[model samples]
Target: MDVQQPLALLGGLSPAQFMRRHWHKKPLLVRQAIPGFKPTVGRAALFELAGREEVESRFIQHKEGQWLLRHGPLARRSLPSLTTPEWTVLVQGVDLHDDATHALMQQFRFVPEARLDDLMISFASDGGGVGPHFDSYDVFLLQAHGKRRWRIGRQKNLALREGLPLKILASFEPEEEYVLEPGDMLYLPPRWAHDGIAEGACMTYSIGFRSPNRAGLAHEVLLRLADAAVDEEASPIYRDPGQQAVAGPGAIPAELQDFARQAVQHALQQPLALECALGEALTEPKPNVWFEPAEAAGMLESVVLDRRTCMMYDDQHVFINGESYLASGPDAALMRRLADERRLMPGDLAKASDDALELLSSWCESGWAHAGLSG
Candidate 1:
C-alpha cells in the first residue's frame, strides 16, 4: 500500500499519518470506515462456527444482576433467544473460517503482518455486554450490524473486580460515549478502558493486534533457540575434567554455570539463528489450526497461500507455519513477494527456478498453499 495515500478506513488519514499521529497514542473514531459495511458472517453462520470443535468461542450473559461465562462449542439450542436481554456470543478468529471475513482483514494490512492478529466477531442481544474491560493490546472495534452504545476512557487505575471470571474494571470511569451504526469504527490504544452495550441485537467486529510481553516473548524465543542448538550437527558439550570436587554437592558448580551461559551465547552466535527462530515463532500456527492435505499437482499455473497459512520473511530466510528456509538472490525475492502478496501469478511462477518450483509443489502438497489464483 502507498503509505502517503489517504484512506477512508483511517478516517481520511494516510497510512503514514495515522501511524505517526494516532497509533498507540490516542483514539480514532471513523465514521463509515467501511462504507455500507455488512456483517461478513451472519448470525446463523456465526453460531454454527461457534459449534465447530476447531473454533474458539465464548458465551456470556448478565441477567438478574449475575454474570455468566461459558466456553463453546455452543449449540444453537444452547444460546439465548434473540429477544433475550443481556446475552452475547463471541467467536474468535473468524478470518480463519470464512473467505469474506479474511478478505475484510486485508484492509488493515497497512500494519506489519507480524503485529497483525486475528479478527473476532461478537453477536449480542439487547443490553448485552461482556462488561467494561481493558485489553493489553490495541483493538479496532467496528460495528457491523444494528447499533451499539460505547463508553470509553483512558483508564488510570487498572484494578479489576475480584472473584469474576472476566477481567472487568472495578471502577469504570467514562470520558466519552457514542452510538455506532454499521460501518462505524473506533480504535483504542492498549490499556484504554471501553464498554459496549447493544442497543438491540447487534454484531461487532474487533480487529486486534499482537503485543507480546517481554517475559512471554523471551520464553518462546529461548525454547526455539534451544531447539535450533540441538538440531546442529556438532554442539559443544560441557567439559569439567579439570574441576575439583565440591564439599557442597547440593549446589550447582560454578564451572557448570559458566558452561550453561556459554551454551546460550553459542546458540546466539550462529548465523542468523535468532532471526530465523523469531520469524518461525511469529508465523507459527495457533494450537487449534489444522490444514487439509492436498495432492501434489503437475504443471502449476498459479499459487495462493492457504488462509490458515502464516508466512513471513527476513533478510536471510522465509518462515511459514513454524518452519524456516534459507533464501537469497532471485529465489529469495520471489519468495518474499509470495509472502507479501500471499499469491503468485503464472508469470511470476515462470520466473521460479526448478528448485523453487519443487519447494512450492511441496508446500501445495502439505496444504500450506494451493494451485490457483486467489479470488
Candidate 2:
C-alpha cells in the first residue's frame, strides 16, 4: 500500500499520517470506517464456530448483579435465550475460519505483519458487555451490527475487581462516550480503559495487535536458537585439568559456569542465527491452528497463502509456519512480495527460479498455500 494515500478506513488520514499521529499515542474514532459494513459471520455461523472444539470461545452473562463466565466449546443449547439481556458470546480468531472475515482484517495491514494479531467477533444480547477493562495491546473495535454505546477514558487506576472471572476495572472513569452504528470504529492504545454496552442485540469486530513481552520473546527465540544449533558440530565439553578440588562439591564450579556461558555466546555468534530464530518464532502457527492436506500442485500459475499461514521475511531469509529458508537476490524480492500481499499473480510467478517454484509447490502440497488465485 502507498503510505501517503489517504484511506477512509483511517478516517481520511494516510497510513503514514495515522501511524505518526495516533498509533500507541492516543485514541482515534473513525465514523464509517467501513462504509455499509455488515457482519461477515452471522449469529448462527458464529455460534457454530463457538461449538467447534478447535475454536477458542467464551460465554459471559451479567444478570441480577451476578456475573458468570464459561469457556467453550459452548453448545447452542447451553447459551442463554436470545431475549436474555446482558449475555455475550465471544469467538476468537474469526479470521482463521472465514474468508470474508480474513479479508476484512487485511485492511489493517498498514501495520507490520509481526505486530498484527487475529480478529475476534463478539455477539451480544441487549445491554450486553464484557465490562470495563484495559488491554495490554492496541485494539480497533469496529461495530458490525446494531448499536453499541462506548465509554472511554485514560485510566490511571489499573486495579481490578476481586473474585471475578474477568479482569474488570474496579474504578472505571469515563471521559467520553459514543454510540456506534455499523461501520463505525474506535481505536484504543494499550492501557486505555473502555466499556462497550450493546444498545440492543449487537456484534462487534475487534482487530487486535500482538504485544509480545520481552521475557516471552526471549524464551521463544532462545529455544528456537538452541534447536537450530543442535544439528551443528558439537562444542567442546568442560575440562578442569589444571583445577584443584573445591571445598564444597555441591556448588557449581566457576570453570563450568564459564563453559556454559561460552556455549551460549557461541550459539548466538552464528551469522544470522538470531534473525532466523526470531523470524521462525514469529511465524509459528498458534497452538489451536491446523491445516488440511492437499494434493501436490505440480505447476503453479498463481498462488495464495492460506489464511491460517503466517509468512514473514528478513533481509536474509523467508519464514513461514515456523520454518525458515535462505533467500537472496530476485527470488528474495519475490518472496517478500508474497509475504506482503499474501498472494502471487501469474506474472509474478513467472519470475520464480526452479528452486523457488519447487518450494512453492511443496507448500501447496502441505496446504500452507493454494495453487491458484484466491477469490
Candidate 3:
C-alpha cells in the first residue's frame, strides 16, 4: 500500500494527502467511492448473522411518530413488517464475518491498525434513522443500496436530551445536506454531528474507527502490565520499620505510598510494555467472538493463517489476538510479512525454519490460526 499513491477509495487523493488535509479535521464526500457497490450478504443472511451471539445487532423502528430500539438475537418474527417503511436492522462488525467486508476494510489500512475498528451495515426502510448523534471516533459512511439523505454540521452545543434511551442531540443544526445513492461515501471526523434518514429501502455501511478514552486505556494497559509483571516473578514484599510508632490507626504510612508508586512505575518501565499492552488491547476479541479449537491432524511443513485473525508486529514483538511473542531473525521477518499481507504464500511458508513451523503448528492447534497445504 503506497501512502502517496492516489486511490479512488480515498476520493482520488493519496492516503498521505487525505491524512494531511482531512483526517480528524473536516468532512469529505466522495461520489462513486465504490463503483457498482452492492451488499455482499442478502437480507436473510444478514438477519441470520444478527441472530448469532457473537455478532452485535440492533433493530430500530420509527412509525406513527414513535421511535423504538431493540437489541438482537432477534427472530425475523420480532422484526417490524418489511412492507412498511421506517424500520431498520443494523449489524456491527460485518468485517469480522464476511471476507468481502474484510477486504473492503483493508483499503483504510493507511490509518493505524489500532484505530481501524470494524465495519457496520445498516439495512433501513424509508425514513428509518437512529436519530441525530455524534461519534467519538472518525467514520466513513458508504451508501450500499437504495438512497439516504444525510444532514451534517460541526456541532458546537454538545447538549443531550435527558431521559432518552439514546444519547440523541437535544438541538441538531445542519449546515450541509446530501442525498447519497449507491457507492457514495461521506467521511466525517470525530464529534461532527450527522444524521442519516433513509429515503427508501436502504443499506449503509459505516467504517468506524476506534478512539479509546484515556482513563479506559490506562485501566486496560495497567492490568496487562500487572499481569506481565507478575509473570516475571518480581513480587517484592513491603517492609516497615519495627520501631515506628503510629499516632493513630487511620494514619497511612508515607513510605508505603512511595513504595506503591514505585511499584507502578517499575511495571511501566519494562521495555516496550506500553507497546505490548496496546497491541494486546487492540486484538482483544469482542465478547461475542469465539473460536473453535483446530483439530491437530499431523505436523505440516507450511500453513495459511485464518482470515479472522488480527496479527500485528512491532520491532521487538509480534501480537496475534491479544497474545505477544518475541520476534527475531527470519521468523520475525516472515511473521511481519504475514501480518501485513494477511496470508502466507507457499514461497513465504517455505522460508520458515523448523522452529517457526513448530510454533505455527501450535497456533493452528490452538485455533488462533489454520493449516493448509502449499498451493
TM-score for each model = 0.97, 0.98, 0.94
CA lDDT of each candidate?
0.93, 0.95, 0.86
Determine which window of 10 residues in candidate 1 has minimal summed lDDT: 366-375
Q: How many clashes in candidate 3?
A: 0
Candidate 3's residue-wise lDDT over 69-132, tens digit each? 7898778877877668888899999988987888888888899777888899999988889889
- Best of the two (1, 2) by lDDT: 2
Off by over 4 Å in 1: 373-375
lDDT of model number 3:
0.86
- For model 2, residues 1-375, the per-residue Cα lDDT tens digits are 999999999999999999999999999999999999999999999999999999999999998998899999999999989998999999999999999999999999999999999999999999999999999999999999999999999999999999999999999999999999999999999999999999999999999999999999999999988887677876576788998877988998888899889888998999998999999999999999999989977678999999999999999999999999999998999999999999999999999999999999899989999997334
Ordering by TM-score: 2, 1, 3
lDDT for model 2: 0.95
Best by lDDT: 2
Better of 2 and 3 by TM-score: 2
